[model samples]
Target: MHTTTSDTAPEQRTAAPRHPVARAGRISAQGAAALVLVLLLLVVVRLPWAGDLGMHAATVERLRHGLLHPGNPLIDADTPSPYYSPWTLLLGIVAKLTGLSVFVVLRLGALAGLALLVTGVHRYVRTLTAHRAAPALALLSLLFLWGPALFSWSGFLGLNSLALTVSYPSVCALGLTFHFWAWLTRAARGPIGWGAGAGLGVLWAVILLCHQFTGVVATLGGLAMVAGARPARATLLRLGTGLLPGLLVLWLWPYYDFFALFSAGGDLEAVHRSLYRDLAGRFGYVLLGVVALGFRLRRDRRDPLALFFALGVLMVAAGGLTGHYSWGRALPAALIPAQLAAALQAVSAGRWALRRGWACVLLVALVAGAWTQAGTLGYVVRRDALPGAVAAKYREPWAGYQWIVRAGVRYGDVVMARRFPARQIPAYGPYTVAPGYPDVFLPDADRREAAMKRYFEAGTGDGERRAILRAYGARWVVGGAPAPWLHKTAVGPRGQVLYRVAP
Candidate 1:
């Protein structure tokens, strides 16, 4: 059924292109300025490159290959994931268009950029609250100083945990925006719009799959929004419907996977081990949010966004105080609501300070503080944003994991490596790993292959290696040095060792 605009003359259709509100155009400049300021303040948050460590890179690479032949085992089917289809579908489209290898880093660049855009969304959402925009922007400015700055030298860069730490807030911001939008429009009697619903669904789904650790904060933020609803049943429907995409993944978590951030017998213990470490990384963020929340609640205390944001920060901070801490990674999912709430307060503070005639002094202080903290922001930006730097890093010799572009790795062979190394290869279904040759193959800790370590060091006999290569199947062994059979050696872009073991 074709629908026309009442078949009215196209010229007579004087409907101007829609803006969220008429003032959006005027405010857009301010919003963009805020975003750029946020982007620039923690300019280093962009980082040295878009973070293409091991598995993250490998997943994109495998997906790239899978696009060419879906059923073909470019990567295996039984990898680990919750089957969150939407983001994976988006990733697949990206893989088909760009291929997996190049996308290894390419995708991270895009992801980091997406993370950065949260500042803009934060600004836009702040616009709704009106009075809170300034401090909200300032708070965002300060947030750039938190994770990346603290973690840049925390010695955990290139690790999944740190990546989760940084990316969680970005995801949280998006969730908060959607939740606020949903609550703001919940009274609409006409068909409840799908725009906010679909958008929130997609973003949260991506967050769930990206790393479940973010669950700590994002979940908190989500509940805050639900609490804002007028009718309990409607709110229940909204929240439940919103989680549909994530539910899909939870159902399929046993089978489909991109990386195993969460799995039985694996690093589940690591999550416990990381408790205090996570708390320390997130201390500054929690503090700032608390202060910002205190200030924002001073005025329009009734706003649900404000209340939820305050509660979340207090809750997480209290948890930290009482040793429930984990950099809130045990709760990063709460990051969205908390930050949104903080942003609301921060913007309010900023506006008040500015309107009260302290705007110039405060803004300068904000920028100066961020600039001093450039070490943090500069890492992510310098890594990938610089021209040719990303490509150059991957071209041959590299320092950080250079955000490189490649067709993708073809992993149809056995891979032999250590605990961490074994974990990184799950995305490549085309390969298996070995230690004692022929018998013990899987290196997954959860897989209970006790002999995995010995396999990497001793599995490389000339004839046996040839036979292992032929029988078990493998194209490359990364980050490991073995005997004569592990032919064709090279260091990875990130300086991890690699061997082009023949399939």
Candidate 2:
């Protein structure tokens, strides 16, 4: 129960004026943050389609049906998958016990993750600064400090990204990461019992098991915390002791080999290339935070935020230089520390005039960032109902393959689809001939991809197409054309046809 307080520096203790105007500003900031959270809650309830929603839902479905040995999440194969994370397992249990649909379970998970994120931010910020406004400012900065291109990725914690991926394991992992740092901050500063150390280790493992990429960010943050504290040898020993349980958990996780992923990076590097694109448009605004980080480093070379930022930059730069784009997932590590530093600098002890000026600049930047991501409103509102300007910001989510489900595609049925539809069909219980996403462990993933390609190729013979269908045991095919081997079952939106594989 030992909790860390904001005792690192005198600047952290600076208090805002008790003047009514200043008080009003603090209340307003908190209110704005609350409003944003409410908006996100509405989004969770609506559950707008984007990114990997289907994959996550498919994971829950698999676990709900067979928790102990849920096979491949997307394809009809008996293979372990990385998507079978601790968070998804819990959701699966809930889905089974309550008999709730996977999407409903996902909504509940999103709410839980959002709550964890909000509370974790509050707790972690308190360990950094005592200013009442620091937590709210930090939360706002974290959400709105990115550049204007509206990048939305799983591990990226920007407002648009979080809105789209609030239900993902990455969000839960990030929330847990904040709590881990808060606990680590206290443990590093003072002594603790062995039990506490072991618990910390378990928590670390859970975060890693929840989302591997976010786990990297968490690891970097932990290292920065310990390095900055210059803890006693006893403290470091306890930390080392804590690490054992974490590694054990990683080794024993039954869903997939966590350690094997290190060598599996080759398949992921190509898909993650997008993380390195449009640097200025996607993250240029964070430079303001980099400026703040510079100020922290000047005050104390061992500042945890400064060290955190440096480590993140090194990892991301190394990834970009070495063609290891998967490492780009760690961008949030650098982005987060910088964002928090900017917020802290705005509220830290300074000349009244200087603080006020910094606050104004931050406020303007936040507003601009918010505007850039206004498209997030599309999730909660009808896109057509929105004004043309707002509608323009909206990125349409996929219409989904539920139509085919209505056409009698049942659980365990194999469906042949192109990559895009394949990504979505598995969410409803049916499996794709090939996984829509990358699968490093699936030994025949290349063969499956090739077979799917041949089946769809214009020059493919009827005999070869039938052979491909027979090889994968596909019961249904989703495409625009009908062949002699296909019996048309149903027509979906956008001229999509669902055809039964004629036996």
Candidate 3:
């Protein structure tokens, strides 16, 4: 009997345990407890409430109240919001099942996503390393060194500071992106079959539904995975067939919106800011990866990690040249791939150092120090906002707006305000707000912003303000000072008045 090398490879691979139960049993009690404690600390950390989170919560509220018959609940006659999201669906389900407020649900969702992301990354690192100790060390490094800068290096995207403040959809989408990569890598390695292919498509669809850009990156990474795996024609055909669901999602609604997104140019200046200054604010793990890559350690030629790393570097370069839409929406997602490669390098280094005595200790200490520094930076970013699930406690900030709502401020009623919090009144209150545009994706946003400024600060008298407001269908004025010419229906705690404007 002739035995080929391939005949014994399967047996050897099967001999290596990959099951969660098998892996869990190998975890030290102390390590498990420490992980639990760290997770708990992350959960307990204060999550701030800001306009974006509030807007998402409000949108979820609309979804929950009319789950069976849904419309764009946030849009009114004055403000047209043609927004669609799968995050709303997830939040609606949680809210319906648990009967919790959208605020609480968002917090829970963010925490869950974060936990999954950390675990998924840890598993990914373990697969890349020669020793299990490397995974543990890498996990610790991620926790301490990972700064929450969501977009560029500046912590401006609310990372470390306002990360929890962004809509849970984006955060959950990011987490989904990570898992999507992991699952795709597995399917790519397996024998091409209906199950694997269909699963890939389904996961791709889910990731797209969760967040569009993250979905695109997932798709790109999937393609890269296919290219790296270099499967047979039959396998490639099966995989293509499996990805039908994802194609269907694009065909359904995403294609139209996606086309619209690109039709309007991105913000190149924002890209420059992120690449030159902001991209370095968080994720010290990136530096570790660069240093490790410099070591020129031999990596597997077919390693998906290499492809992902190349893709990430490509993203940074491309991200810098694209407009705002690409920069804000698609580019930041490159962090997932970059982190994956960096983490692999970091873990490999740890595994290498295990043989070199105390060098590993010194390296870990450096990472720990970097984490401490990142934490300090995070504190500076988040210090202005109150913590602990702002959605649940948002009423304090919305007190003035709530008063206006209680005063019978009708739906579609437009109010003008220039203040930051004033702009948020529409999301928190029952009425619409005019000269208060929130969308950055629209092509005419610059025009609308300029028009809004003209309506507020540029106007000299009540006649000018009234004419401008009337044109946009403005019927109220929400601000710290009342428009003396208009009738004040209510005055809020901070002396903010909701004045009734006549057509």
TM per prediction: 0.60, 0.97, 0.73
User: What do the candidate models score in CA lDDT, each in turn?
Assistant: 0.41, 0.89, 0.51
Among the numbered candidates, top lDDT falls to: 2
lDDT of 3 by residue, 1-503 (tens): 11212311121222323546434523542274365335344533544444455566656666566665444343343222323466677677788888886667777766776666556655554434444544454444433434434322211222332243334565565556656665655555545578778877876776676665566666666676666555666666778898787667645743124434444433434434544445455554355544444442255454555565567567656655554324434444344444444434432332334423333442564355343334323322343353434222223223325577687676445566664544456555343432243453444555545655766673366667667676656677776344656787887777777788754
TM-score of 3: 0.73
**Candidate 3, position 495, lDDT:** 73
TM-score of 2: 0.97
RMSD of each candidate relative to the true structure? 9.9, 1.9, 6.8
For residue 468, give model 2's deviation from the true position in Å.
0.6
**Candidate order by TM-score, highest to lowest?**
2, 3, 1
User: After superposing candidate 3, which stretches have Cα over 4 Å from the reference?
Assistant: 1-46, 65-83, 93-99, 126-167, 254-256, 266-285, 294-297, 321-325, 328-338, 341-413, 429-431, 434-448, 473-475, 487-503
What C-alpha lDDT, on a 0 to 100 scale, does residue 5 get in candidate 2?
A: 32
